[model samples]
Target: MGVKALLSKPLAAYVHKKDRSWIENPVEAQQAVFKSIVRKAQATRFGRDHGFSAISSHADFVQAVPVRDYEGLSSYFNRVKQGEKDVLWPGKPLYLAKTSGTTSGTKYIPITSDSISNHINGARNALLAYVHETGNSAFLDGKLIFLSGSPELEEIGGIKTGRLSGIANHHVPGYLRTNQLPSYQTNCIEDWETKLDQIIEETIDQNMTLISGIPPWVQMYFDKLMRQTGKPIKDIFPNFQLFVYGGVNFEPYRKKLFESIGKEVDSIELFPASEGFFAYQNQQQDKGLLLLLNDGIFYEFIPVEEYFKENPTRLTIGEVEPGVNYALVISSNAGLWSYSIGDTVKFTSIKPYKVVVSGRIKHFISAFGEHVIGEEVEKAMQRTMAKFPTVELIEFTVAPHVSQDKGASFHEWLVEFSREPQNLEAFTDELDQQLQKLNSYYYDLISGNILQRLKITGLPRGTFRDYMKSQGKLGGQNKVPRLSNDRKLADGLLGVAKL
Candidate 1:
């Protein structure tokens, strides 16, 4: 948090020329570089058969750390692939992301080598405070695009590497990245359909300033880079600027990806995972917040009033401070120690702390703020099925309840039966008017219905996450909770299951 306090920040004059006295240096030198990344992510979360032990507040690190998913890193990633180091991390495991777990179907998450040099030092301190708050790194000189999940590297119980976007695109620094696309091929460990059709024809005509991933694969790589260049994404990148993106919650498809890139998209918000790259975005993009990448994630927020009291409340990275609303905890180096990557944040100001990504400590529906995650209801159901092409679909989910006669609470849309349109309640009322033209506070609280007010069900004969993958518990890390404000398992599977 420096660049001379963001060069007097108005987003640092809109994007460059920072030095606000290195963001008022000294929060004890940012906790001595977050206690040396919490003693190297607590030596990869107490590996070599559990060891390191140091506790302080935030309810004594959630009563000495106890909250892990990714099924406790797939039971210590099958003992770190037999080349064993006991469990968490000690010897190997440096970079490996290759994700796909909503039930560990395709895995590997590690991310060590000091969390890949803490994700390139948190992407060069969030691009030097986003070029000192948008003064302009030319919004990051063209050709950055990420939209990942198909780079290479494969393995977990077998242990391979590369894949956090091909090890950050084969270790970034090829003079900071840009040979248009195709180049991370250490024999390109192939997967996700062998380089997504030439990575969608090498990002169609190149030149893409900072666009990052996740939005139905960046609108299927911008609709196949706009029908193979018939053009109209501002003429294939008329100097496109910022557009980062996180796993979800893109404020209801931000006006359809800013009206399909016609303009205004200088975006941000990352909070990376696959075990690291902790938090980002604070170049005054949306007015400063979400900071702690603390030199490779050693953070630990946890507070939404002690997350339902099984005992919670843990704020580190120098005792948090701002407006509170926590829950993150990392420890990193791919060993995940004080682990609890569920997410749920909120902090607005405190010297250089800043933050506010509030949701998903377990995917959405915390009543109304409808995080509806899993990539914002997969971009509000692909912008409401791209305005219906015979309403074809093969899957869906979005439960959340509370309507005992409009006591108020919304979002229902269960779906799964493919085709539609025999006026099924006017095709479910134009898919709830395309999620209320993509959010007008969810279109005045679901048309004054006070949030989705029930009734969309469907699923004809399948879809309770395909019965949680016919009971294999749907693979590894397990998913299918794209927001469930209520509806207790879709009301006991509509009282009989079968659909």
Candidate 2:
């Protein structure tokens, strides 16, 4: 066997060994990670002020630190950006990973040496886990492409700053560069459309076997390739066997992506963000992702039902149970202390700590006490679309229409479709039925006549794309909001569609 194939054996062995240890005792592994972080950061400002040096157990740590969001931690981050050393983490950060800021203004997240190591190792172990399970050694012999943002980083506050994907690309091991596609020059193009064209030109004929990206952009790339070559994606890259994706749920985009691929391929979902690499799909047989318990991130969860209370109880790894939606909180080596990243998740397995993203804390629709979340809406959409095989959804967003012009408040969904449903009324009815079955609050509201039925506006093709472009968030980790508590985003989208 060649050297490349031989390399997989040792890597797979290492991953399996570590994974076994973690799975056998996830609670112990998390406690160990938490202790290590406290020891390392004990001298830092946050740790010292929070009494981390005196803390000896999880209960003490919990008592010392309170849950904080981005707004709460902004001051400390601002100090770090001003060249303050040992503020959040030890010494100054090596770089900052800038968030896409879809919900608010841009945020500069710290990327320290230790945190970056976790990111790199977590990603490597994820791939190793896949290989260990499937014994797919030939994957390494061919090219693997990561369709990501531009790699050209800019200087901010005397520190290098760029998108998380670009920062990750900068750390790609020298040995793996040979099998990676879209040469560094191509990855540096700033404009997404220009970069897509360049990427297609450079990789259309390459021996690509693995592709990693968000589902929507990858679909766009595949569509452009088919338009250019007059052939399906599998014909262009027959060796393509794995599709790695993150940043958004795969359910909404699965059918269209498979149709674009024209064949079945193994897929792995990841839960990565600017804050940290949180979880990854570890087993092919399991639907939920295995939470990375031993990573540098220390996790805390607040029950979503009580999240808005004056003081919500924070649950540690040992306290979390299956089937409950919780707002995830973390105290990472990157300097965040008990920070809520605004995402909600439901645990599926407690023994090994497997979870699935449920929704965002701020991105929910509770206009009339329905309290509908992204997970409910997504599943509803999936059921609705399953009945109309001819129609494919491109993008959609929902908001409350509170104006009394109709005498009752109703939810409005603006949808962009690749193919129109045969009967719009039937489609909307199916959507409403699925939602009623999924959410009891929404069902009660509709049945009791407190809220009118859901209404859908068929947006012209490319409405979401246009709105994102108009907002200067055209690509790379930017997505249109799926649900809004108010009508601002939905109305803006409608106004843009009219233009």
Candidate 3:
């Protein structure tokens, strides 16, 4: 990016003031966040007392609004898509971020004016704070590449709207905007055959200094690059400084990606879903720190106390303390109120707010109804993995579905390692039992009796990402769901023909 553009308005704060820490005082900090949506709720949308939304205080509004996922917002978004404004925001939106569904349908979430400004500034502040913590911002000047969704726009009634990444790029400081690498992805092209071919064509021969994307797609792209070029990935992008990934627990895919490239280096994960960029790397190098976007989205944490006890403790950003695991809830400028992002985190320290990824809260399997969390499973897997030979976990999914009629019960595990196991079934089963032993709940379930079915199947070379890409679900926001609770989904995924 040119120095002149980097010195412009939106970037000035990020570029020049990158060294500064957060500036707002306590009360002002609270108010700055509170007003992001409250003022709109009370405006012309509501005539008298801004009669629009009924909830008064922050907590009141949050309490009044029930949590919802993508399906709940579909119709309202369809209206915005039709070029008729609905209640998401008062003004015309700046862009629509493209996202996919479990069935692979496309979603164009509105990028409102407030949301645009909040995202840009919030990202800048995140970078600023990261630089402050690291003591420099030279990475900002490096060639940055995002593993993003397609930049294609769609119109319900023939009016061209914007894709999420394109709009985000469009809003960047005009000077540095051109600094972003060209994306060959089209937001609307989300099918297996059409999208993967384009991803393969567009991503070749680029000097990607900084790389970003869902880990599965990034890994898939690089594998294809290695096959066609017959050279290590390091040779393709010699300037590549870092790997930025998110959308799924990166550990599963990261190991394979690094191995495929024939090397390893430091990496960062940007945990952003279609909702908004929730958190970025805190730059501490200890563990992932969820530096709360104090001003962008009103953040809340639900304590594990609820998991242990009946009533969960919910803490606001201001109330967060050290060593407590929380299931996060967010209310953003884009109109998602008390939205659950489905991940669990624990604060390791307070003053600057450091956190370790605890696990997925309600998103894991409960075979024998044991309620094994992602963190529990991941921790056990990591422990066993740390001692094993250089083996890869090609696929691991837990399915709780049992034949109740047959009285069968157990967590079924499927794994494909890099180095062939001397006794594949025995080794994998022992690992499974060891993992179950670590989580007390799973232990009770298993100790009672043998599981209905526990299977381990080996994947032929290049199966995981090839399947994901062949299915045409590659890019920035989408990822291979690492952990799930459903048995059928697991079975179907495992049974699918190899790519």
Q: Higher TM-score: candidate 1 or 3?
A: 3
Over 283-361, each residue of candidate 3 has an lDDT whose tens digit, in order, gives: 6475565554444677767876464443345567678777676887776667655666566787776555656666666
Candidate 1 lDDT by residue in tens digits, 1-499: 3333334345445433343443455255445554554455454534324434464333544555565666665666666665565356566775556655543466666765556777765655566666655556664445665645434565554556644655676566654564334445422524333455566666666776667666534654665567777776777888787777665555544555666677786776766666766567765546445465335455666675566566565566567766555777666545666666676666677666666565566655546654444444555566666666456554456777665766466677776554665567766666667666655566777666666544577766545534664543332223345556666656645643554
Give the winner by TM-score: 2 or 3. 2
lDDT of every model, 2 decimals: 0.58, 0.87, 0.60
Query: Candidate 3 has what TM-score?
Result: 0.81
The sequence of per-residue lDDT tens digits that candidate 2 reaches over residues 1-499 is 5567579878898879967887788888889989998999999988888998899987798788888887788888888888889989999888999886655588999999889987887777788888888887677778888988888898877889998899999888776788898899989887888889999998999988899998888888998999999988999999899999988888889998899889999988889988999999988889799999887898999999988887789888999999999999998888888989999999999877899999998889998899999999999999889998888988888999886654388999889888889999999999999999999999998998888889999899778888888887776777777899998988888898873
Q: Model 1 — TM-score against the truth? A: 0.31
Superposition error at 136 for model 3 (Å): 6.8
Superposed on all Cα atoms, model 2 deviates from the true structure by an RMSD in Å of 1.4
Give the RMSD in angstroms, all C-alphas superposed, for model 1: 21.7
Winner by lDDT: 2
**Can you tell me which runs of candidate 2 are displaced by over 4 Å?**
405-407
- If scored against the real structure, what TM-score would every candidate get? 0.31, 0.97, 0.81
lDDT of 3: 0.60
